[model samples]
Target: MENAQTQLEINQCAGINLLAAKRKLVNVLEKIRHAYKSASPEFLTKLDVSQKAWEESLEADMEMKYPLEDKRLQYGSVYPMCASGFESRLVLARVEFLKEWLKGHQDGDICSGSIIHSYSIQRDCSNIGK
Candidate 1:
């Protein structure tokens, strides 16, 4: 983007960045699915449903951001670049959110829920009150 002097060039760069972010998102999601492969069928179904809902939410957010019927006409020439950059940020955020599943929580954390527990730290939670 440093050399993107023209609006067209900037817009193209933004679009390319957006595509890269989307690919990263796909990779993260695949890793998450693989990590939880041993989970029950119902867990997998819920994961799929959650992903679909997140996608719908993302689309709704984009629509709300640019509520006009004709975004290009309403926002002018830079609309494409802005929209692409905004979408890229949102996707990167989602990737970060999904990464927690891969990282997992400490073994003693009882609230870890479905996330795989990490036994790297051997902590005793039973003596917390003492």
Candidate 2:
């Protein structure tokens, strides 16, 4: 059926998008690692350690979103396909967050104490929780 084919395509594309987003996130992290190379030794060590933990957390979160125990028949079920879409969105969010955080760093807007603080606070904070 046409609807089934479309759903399959969407599911496949979602997986590709998720992989691409994850790659982008890793690339951004690598850029950040390089950008902060001149920081103090303590900071560099902390960054390295945190980077490993962050990668682990990402893996864990992805596994949670697509657990193997809940496998659905791909032919008639939409659950697995929808899971891919959700994963794609989550990965894309991480990519955007890293990019925005990098932009904040480049803008020298860290006078607000934290890197993301200035950008988030300066934005229309009213729309944040909405």
Candidate 3:
């Protein structure tokens, strides 16, 4: 019973963190949209392409690291429960990068065509591997 409760708690935590991370990313993207509205066509195109590339890269990385599979009844795979946590970590890293860029803006507005450096936060998933 205790182990079951613990598993339930882990699932819930993962769900909540995933939601929060997504929300943060959305907020950051909205900010960028507002900031880049008046940018040159070429610059805007580049920004759009880069944004898509970043998301695709993140998704590909996640899929590589955590291929969606249910082995819970067999070898006791916890991936089913841990997927949310891994996704949350990735989203949170992007969110943090955006937030830092916003903070560093000199005029309180992200300048059009400005390229902000991307930073990634390293996360240890060793605990989840168990």
Candidate 4:
């Protein structure tokens, strides 16, 4: 990106970055699915639903960010680059959010919700003060 000179080059770089981020997202999702394969069917279904909703939300956000129907005409030549870069950042943020399932939460945390406890950190937290 730093080496990109022309607007064309910059847009190309942004597209490349976006593709890479999407690949990372796919990999992270696959890891989560594999890790939680034995989880309840309802949990798996919810994960799928959540991912779909997030994608829809992201698209809506982009639409809101560039509300003009003729985005290219309104935003000019930099629209592609700017939009791609912004979308990449959003996708990377989503990847980080989804990673909570992989990282999990400490056992005995009441606020942990659906995230499984980190198996490596498993302990009888209730007995900690004993």
Q: How does each model score on lDDT?
A: 0.81, 0.60, 0.61, 0.85
Overall local distance difference test of candidate 3: 0.61
Q: After superposition, how far is residue 129 of candidate 4 from its true place, in Å?
A: 39
Best-to-worst ranking by lDDT = 4, 1, 3, 2
Q: Write the per-residue lDDT of candidate 2 for residues 1-130, one digit (tens) a residue.
A: 2344676676776667667777887777775545444445675677568667766887788677666765575324666567766766766776676665355433545462324433433352334224
TM-score of 2: 0.57
Q: Estimate each model's TM-score.
A: 0.87, 0.57, 0.63, 0.87
* Cα-based lDDT at residue 22, candidate 1: 98
The residue-by-residue lDDT of candidate 4 on 19-116, one tens digit each, is: 99999899878777766667677888999999999999999999999999999899999999999999999999999998888787885789977777
Task: For each candidate in turn, give its C-alpha RMSD to the true structure in angstroms.
Answer: 8.1, 8.6, 10.9, 7.0
lDDT of residue 118 for candidate 1: 44
* Residue-level lDDT for 79 in candidate 1: 99
Q: What count of clashes does model 4 give?
A: 0
Backbone clashes in each candidate structure, one number apiece?
A: 0, 0, 0, 0
